[model samples]
Target chain A: MNVAKHMLFPDVGEGIREGTLVKWLVKEGDPVKEDQPIAEVETDKAVVEIPSRDHGTVLKLYGKPGDVILVGKPLMTVGEPGEPMPDAEEAITESNEKKVEVPKKEASAAPERILAPPSVRAAARKAGIDLSKVSGSGPGGRITAEDLEKAKGGALAAPASTHQEKTLSFDYGKGKRVPLTHLRKTISERMSWSWRHVAHVTYIEEVDFGALKELRGRNKPKAEQMGFKLTPLAYMVKAVATTLKQYPRFNASLDEEKAELILHDEINVAVGVDTEEGLIAPVLKNADQKSVFDIAKEIGGLSEKARARKLSLDELRASTFTVTNIGSVGGVLATAVLNPPESAILGVNRMKDRPVVRDGKIVIRPMTYLGLTFDHRVGDGADAARFMKDLVEKLENPAWMEKG
Target chain B: MSRKKVFEAQIEYLQILDEKGNVDASLDPKLDELTLKKMYETMVRSRAMDKKAISLQRQGRCYTYVPTEGQEAAQVGSVMASKKEDWMVPAFRENAAYLAKGVSMRTLFLYWMGHEEGSRFEKDQNCFPVSIPVGSQVGHAVGLAWAAKIQGKRQAAITFFGDGASSEGDFHESANFAGVFQIPCVFICQNNQYAISTPRARQTRSETIAQKAIAYGFEGIQVDGNDVLAMYVATKKALEKGYAGKGPTLIEAITYRIAAHTTSDDPKRYRDEAEVEAWRKKDPIARFQTYLKKNGFWNEAYEKEVQEKAAREVEEAVKKAEGFQANPEDMFKYLYQDLTPDLRQQMQEMKQSLEG
Candidate 1:
């Protein structure tokens, strides 16, 4: 009751535009069922098991896993349990399918074989190994199986000892990466690409902390009592915002069109929070508008939320400026990424005591280092320094916030 | 962790407005008199329409209606500033955008009344059918804007979705495409803090919905959807940049869904009244109304007039929509451009069965 036909791959609901066939279950001349695991196809989401559409003997295996297959391509051939051959032209479509895997099984069983699994068979044929001459190590030892490792100079091979082994190795100079999360994967690619293509210049400086320490000390307790910790972090936050306003150029991004600097009106800042998986930065939308109380409270809140993991989708976006506190982890200085699209990022290191001259007196005071990475495709050093100067001034005087 | 941090991005997370018609503008935009009044009016209209749609659903006059009672400013402001030619794709809860985009009250009601013709709009009205499948239309809007880019058209497409739709793969696909193509598309995610009964805190560990846009390329933004003017200005700038072929913009409108997800859903089951009441104090419409009435742009008389006007218009649409005859065979139509031989035979058989 059956006619000859090859089952082509169908476009399933998963929206896999194209896929790599991972491996095939059947080889030539193998009988298969209608719902047999014919092949494994890998997509962006996951590897999917594709099943056969019809039941029949596998006349041929058209493609192997790791080969890219388009939707609707021929996968396997099927016919009745005991059947006569149909015209090859009509039976197997160029767009139809075929299947089977028979290592060392005689390839002569089907007189109507059109194609092999891979084009590698042609290379093997050129090596002058007569099929009937070699003893087969493959299933059934019928001399039907070819080998990747063969004798070169008339050495007769002995039966191989079997031991299964798998190794995961690494070279000191080499590196391997398994994707952690899709987001981290994306971040790694973008950053590496940016580092490769974008001409990055780093201008880092160590600042005197004498005057700023006094200013923050005066305000810290008051901020703490108000349920806001006036940590050096908050002082830094205000500084970044204040500096952006003074040095508009540092706040500016590349406006490619007018061929000039495009300064933003609002100084929205983002702070990076360390999480178990990786780092996540959420923005404080309009930083310039908030008072010392508001900024401090918001900074503390956003950081805590990121830790406790209460951030909504909105809390993650909207920032014109950003700060990374690598300083908290005791790092003196490290270049930070520009976070892309945004023109600059300010990297902070831990506050440590150092000698500094304040108002003509030399004494040991708490000081930290700053590394500012800018998109020179947009900003200049003068712009960055001007921002730093204003920021330093603000950190030295929190009372200046009321001046506006 | 003692719940130490909150993602308090200025635009998305804040509560300065109180329900008794008071606002602290230090943390928010000070709504001007005229704009404030308009916000309130739109809110009232949206709420009334929501109630009407629920009634219609209860009466079996419509299939389903996703009400937007407390989220008027969110849906309105998300796409309020979009250009006429720009696209407006809705995920069912966007009655505000339908009104804002000028899709005509009659047409929107017609759609709910089960008329396919409801989706047929004037060429100038670039809106798509109300998408039932969550997050799918966002990718469609992205596609349209991308095509606009290929054609060099200075038009952006704005797509709307609820917080729940954010979890779907299509949302990621749409966002990724918009970012990759830098297409003029605005992804307006209304984070009403709930996807059905599930709260916002459960969706994902991502920092923000807007941040998803950054993954693709351009910028992700969170705007106060309840603060109408804030929503208006932010969305405007994003759309302006987008139309100039800058890239796709992701605007997450942070607001509260004051009512149940729909008339069919019971918010009481999943949410407490206390939480709802707290958010009600920050209601966008009331705050805007207070600002407007104080500025002399509106009063009780004007409020009553517009309210009556909107109510009448909606009521008329409902009546007309119900009166329109529905051809029973319309269901079998529009499967393809033209019916195939097999389909024609099936339809012929159906006619005989109906006659017998």
Candidate 2:
């Protein structure tokens, strides 16, 4: 008796063209039930588990993890035990052929860091030779396919090994060696990565805090009634978001792999919170669309959640720009490191009563320094100056805050 | 000269059944036992299917779905008021209306599952495919009614739209055309308080959506959409007027979208949770069930049977829909009576690629 096989196709979400096969829950020949989750597929929006449409033994697993499956493409085949396989092999082979062709083309188009021809590089890849180690005999140290053949089965034939540098030890020997927490390790890795990749140019601007102070004082009682302290950081975030609308370059991310700059539509300002464990930035999503009072309350809640180590992943991601307040810590002025992907970060430092010449006479005014560290890859120092000037003007004349 | 009132218009509000499930006996349509039971069962099925569809979308079995959780009475009641010959033109969120008009649950599920085959209804079903562009279907509905009128058919056309559609120029144009031609049409606006994030208040400055019909020279009335009896009475009256060769009538059914605008939306972003909680009390299904029980048309056993039957039907439909094998060739077929030269070449190429 001939039994038909049931193919499980993807129906992840609307307008989702394709998804990455994250994992398969069931292997071939395993019996599965209807509506049983068969595989985890990551779509453009989120990771979703695609369930089996019929109860039967899994006949064929279509693709492995990291495989790109198009929408409406069958992920697997299920059929009765001892059933003969149908003509699905052709479709599977077709998809596999397409996937195989993509990577070969991408590898050939890689940046020309090493001096080698495409054919020679392909031969080196097949022979498992680290071409970078082979001293080329050609002009300008170009490795030929002949050199690759000669290097095969030799010391340079092995897969590229990671650089293992030795660390110099000091004789102090009396300090405790506590392992870094996951958060600390993550922060360290991200900061170092940002520092290495970003072309950072920080610009500092001095602004009078008279208008901002007066505005905060006027709203302080109202904010207190709403059960949260109205900090200057809220005003700074609001001002930054407002100014970012004009300076679109600052409210963007650099896609280094794609060599593109993505201008974010929403101004999600991730405010840096110094918790007991380390520092974490919880995003106040769509800060430009929100009122200062709402931002203040959200900041308070986010700080509480951050201190309690209870911030959700959604709250910690998709921040277009970052704001770090060094006021409470009493910093005169500080340049902050750029958050990875984000084009810029604003560091607001402590306020001070400084003597300034006003109308040719010396006078005391409350002032603060605003530092803007931006990715020069996205903009220049002149653009950063303009952004800072706009921000400083907004901070000094903050009558717009009352428009809320 | 002394000032005189040249013209005056008043919008009528009708409510046969209160929120507490008490029906005014004088205003009740007095539907037969089987018809009443069918109406209630259809609403319950719509609700069950809506819940299941949302779950399916979350589980990645279905795509984004526009749920009809709170506006079932408005949909079922209005559809039940029309005859089988009447045309049902619907916007996207009319799953209840479609179900009542003899469109299968499997078809709707398949459509939301991202299949074009789902939109191709049975030949006898006079319901149009789901329209995505807001208020764009109003013109098609008016055209359908105009065609019927030109052909000397007595069947009236009924269109379903949301409060957001009321602001669309298509709706205004269609209403004006319908009124000028005295076309046999019934326009039902499911004023579910929101069009995505834009609330009804922001959609228009009109004091009431029903009053807008006065400008188009038609009688418009508002009804408590959650009250099945009120919706049934109002729609019945409007359809009667439509079939009697009188001009079109607009029925503004006041309701709320208890769920998100669609599966992808987050109502919490714009709407208050307390508002949803309050609307939950006025749920159409629950309210109708109470009315049915008080009228001796429903009991626990019947309710259990209806619910179990709906659940079973929905599961079977879902199973059938998921098992459907859509042919790639169908994409090229049915779009035109004869494929153009360019389309034929593309089809051949697609077929060759697939076979390869």
Candidate 3:
């Protein structure tokens, strides 16, 4: 069979100079995909599972387990099955070939040559004591019944913590105390840190959702056809992203060490999704760069992923701001704690038809109370007011969102 | 008949000091003892820093680093020729050049450790951040020189590149622009035999990179890149011509990359160990140290002091770099003067993900 030989080198991680081959996942003549795990390499950073850089059958194994491989040095040769192995000049010759021939696999299935007699073995087996682990004091290191008795109390004893007893206090009423899961722990730590560090200021404003409701009605069918349910939160995300361009300070994080405000350039909005377990926010990346319809579709997909607990790490990271739609749960107004380093969070309350005077006349309008919580260290009250003013305008004039 | 014998250009080779530490007194620039001592110390410090960076990369403390092991004389000598007010434009391999321009070792270590603050130089430093894209900084150097000329500033610009960069369109474009405008710029191509794995022979067919400058209507000279005095003399003369409005000068420093192109590269795959061994004998640091010892400017005690001082400084820099805490938000902060709507959302999304 005609075949082209390609060398496989160690590219385990960036800045890694060399690594020891811990084990080979694929052997000679095994088929491999482009990203299939072929070997495990231990570098200074970590033990990395190296994926194949090409698709072919492994023609030759250049380095065995425990062999040190330099970063650019070839670790294997991959080619078609039954291809002729490269000559001595190209492949790592002589020593490596001899080393490969020396089998390093352990004879794991061989029964242990125990020195105990049949009666002693029977007794030890009955007592559940392993005679192999006991060092016999008898002649030629034979295991006696006495040694077995001593070993029973030593090696195979149960762990200490499993049976430890503790005194209970019944002063308080009986209740079930459950430990926090990983997600809950993360939420507690982050919220506590944010609350302790940030100097928060909450600004509440009433936003007219009449234009957004009309836009949502017009686009709901089209959104459903695209396989997603459209909601007002999508318009809110677009408005926040669009208004962030004008009020960049609100989309900034304060670096306490450097004492500088870091303004982000990409407007990625994290929508808070209420799941059965807890609240999880999945990010819609580059919200301003996307259309309202696209944002709506992503919001639907992300919320589903969040609820299913299948959201990938990339989908949940690098968000510049957050929008919590408390409006769906029927809240008049609610203030959200600032997500640390994010500077602000927008809490959208429920929209309702309320009587208000626009031009000296009583009018029924769909209005919602929007609460903006910001870090006072990063921006002032005026900055927050100006930001909300721009956001409110964009939400009220929702036609502008359709264009871009 | 009109095309007969119109013009003839020749490239001059300059070597003030030999590999054996012998100097041609007539060609010596006669730099003061203090300046000569400082030059040697800078080269030593640059070598120490390069060594430390490579070690750090191997230990997983630093990122992929480009070592300036063999090109110290080329960088330091050229920088010594220019004034502090002159702008310094650099390619990625100019660690020694940055050191000579007063850029702290901590800043350099921080940069290699993947911090953005590493590139933030003080306003008076007049040094640009290390340009990773090969040959791209050539245009910036020319532009800076042009800007200075227009603003009636008395300063010039010195740009450092490699032999690999000479083949880039940016290099040729910058040279043509500088020559046409007679801008105050000095281009130093540290022709250290190999650019990563590609050797000088494969990089170009030209007999010498310096000769390419004649086509653009300017002077070009080749210097023994290992000879510090020769490099300094060539750069000083080029800077003088630039200040006199005589356009730009290209100096080709013939040296060898004694170490691998970078910490990630293995030169044994493409180069002969014998060649590397031979070049190691003509080591720039050794040659300069020899010259200093012969002139009585360097003694055993002084050498010990300089080495210890360099080690201490590099250690301090490493500690500072490791201790630095970079805010994750800094990634988006420097992209623009203010965050765009899209970027603002992106930053928020990142914060949420991390906090969550």
Kindly list the per-residue Cα lDDT of model 2 for residues B175-280, writing each as its tens digit.
9999999898899999999989998889998989988889999999998888877888888788788778887999999999998788766565577778899999
Candidates' lDDT values, in order? Answer: 0.70, 0.85, 0.83
Model 2 lDDT tens row, A285-309: 9999999999999999999988866
- Docking quality (DockQ) for each candidate: 0.02, 0.09, 0.03
Q: Which stretches of candidate 3 lie over 4 Å from their true place?
A: A1-18, A21-404, B1-3
> Residue A379's C-alpha lDDT in candidate 1?
65
Model 2 C-alpha RMSD vs. true structure (Å) is 13.4
The recovered share of true contacts, given per candidate in order, is: 0.00, 0.16, 0.02
lDDT, residue B179, model 1 = 79
**1 versus 2: better DockQ goes to:** 2
Q: Which stretches of candidate 2 lie over 4 Å from their true place?
A: A1-11, A17-404, B1-3, B58-64, B114-116, B264-274, B337-341, B348-356
- Native interface contact recovery, model 1: 0.00
Local accuracy of candidate 3 as per-residue lDDT tens digits, B190-227: 99998888989999999999999998988899999989
Q: Candidate 1 lDDT, tens digit per residue, A1-404?
A: 56667665554322334566666878777888755677765544234456665567887666664456656556666776456544446544543422322322334564433233233345446665543445555433433323423431243344431221234686757475333443355568867766755556667777666666677677777777777787667667777876777666656566567777667787888888897546778788778777767777887888887765456546776677788898776666788877755778888877898878868999887787888888777767877776676666666555675321
On a 0 to 100 scale, what is the lDDT of residue B304 in model 2? 92
In model 2, the Cα lDDT at residue B313 comes to: 93
Question: Number of the top candidate by lDDT?
Answer: 2
